[model samples]
Target: MFELRHVSKRHGAIIALDAIDLSIAAGQTTALIGPSGAGKSSILRMLIGLEWPDAGEVRFDGVPLRRETLLEQRRRIGYVIQEGGLFPHLTGASNAALLARTLGWETSRIEARLRELAELCQLPFAALSRYPAELSGGQRQRVGLIRALMLDPAVLLLDEPLGALDPIVRHDLQTQMRELFALLNKTVVLVTHDVAEAVWLGDTLVLLRAGKILQKGGIDELLDVPADPFVHQFMNAQRRLREDA
Candidate 1:
């Protein structure tokens, strides 16, 4: 569904991604996990064309991502970031319907789609009428998911979607997210720092560090035959934290 070939991206003096090659399978959920500065979010941004590689290529459905076609390509992809990335002034419904409105969808069609997605994401029907500032953290995240899934895109790119929510909300949403992924069967790329979250929700895990991929495979493979010491430590970090706690 997506491919990054020798991709290198730098933000000024910072190297966000360095000559990394990756391929995300269609109809599967792949998690990008690593520590700070590991380039997980950078990869997600590139996939959606918000950022471009300084060298190498980023391809979607076999076509190289180009500026001229980025907007069109984006319509086929849904993306959500932390805290929903909602506009401060817009109502949750308005934020979720932004793309459809831009595409000239009718008001009735937009409202109908919003109703469908609100239910899918398990968001309260009345919450859509509230502004971003008026919603709780979980509600805001749900609003974000509704926005991302509103267009019924072929791919979903989530960058730390649950990172900010409380543990209770996060746990519940994890189940919902997994069900949604399986039900939708879209190519999903998730960026997270939590190994347990990645293992639980992802079909495949891609561990990165300092802008390079150190390991990529199933949870068992990563746990049993880690590519490096960092992979082993990272995969077991949750257990280690528990033991220490």
Candidate 2:
């Protein structure tokens, strides 16, 4: 559903992505995993047209991602960032309905969709009436999920959506998200620093470091046939943490 061809991105002295070629399949969950500054989030931003690559191209569903078609393309993609990325001034309900309202959806339709997604995300309908500061961390994330799914976009792109939550909330949301992904059967691309989370949620894993892809495959493949020594180190680090903890 998404492809990157020799994509390179730079932020002055820092290289965010370095001519990396990758493709994300439709109806599958692909996790972008790595340590800090690995360029995982950079790829996500490019996919959603938030940032452009310094060189090379990003394509979605066979078409190049052009600025002219960006608005249309974005409407077809759902994005959720950490801590819900909510607007402080707007209530949760208003935040979720922003896109649909812009598209001229009826009030009844928007409310109905909000309720449906609130249930799907395991958030209470009443919570939508509250502002971002009024909701808890978990509620904020759920609100974010509701906003992303409000339009029922074809693809869901999440950049550490649960990273800021407590462990219990994060785990519960992860379980719910796994089931939701299976139920929706939509293409999903997740960016995360947690290897275990990536393994638990992602159908395929793409490990990156220093702005380039080090390996792409299942966890077992990474364990048995690592493309680079860094891949094994990265996996083992996660395993060791769990074992030690």
Could you estimate the TM-score for every candidate?
0.95, 0.97
Q: Tell me model 2's lDDT, rounded to 2 decimals.
A: 0.93
Error of 1 at 52 (Å): 1.0
Q: What is the lDDT of candidate 1?
A: 0.91
Q: Where's the lowest-lDDT run of ten residues in candidate 1?
A: 236-245
Clashing pairs in 2: none
Best by lDDT: 2
Off by over 4 Å in 1: 240-245
Which portions of model 2 show Cα errors greater than 4 Å? 240-245
Q: In model 2, what lDDT does residue 91 have?
A: 99
| Candidate 1 C-alpha lDDT tens digits along 1-245 | 99999999998899999899999999999999999999999999999998889999999999999999998999999999999999999999999999899989999999999998888899888999999999999999999999998889999999999999999999999989999888888999999987788877888899999999999998878888989999888777666432221
Candidate 2 C-alpha lDDT tens digits along 1-245: 99999999999999999999999999999999999999999999999999999999999999999999999999999999998999999999999999999999999999999989999999999999999999999999999999999889999999999999989989999999999999999999999988888888889999999999999998789877889999888888776433322
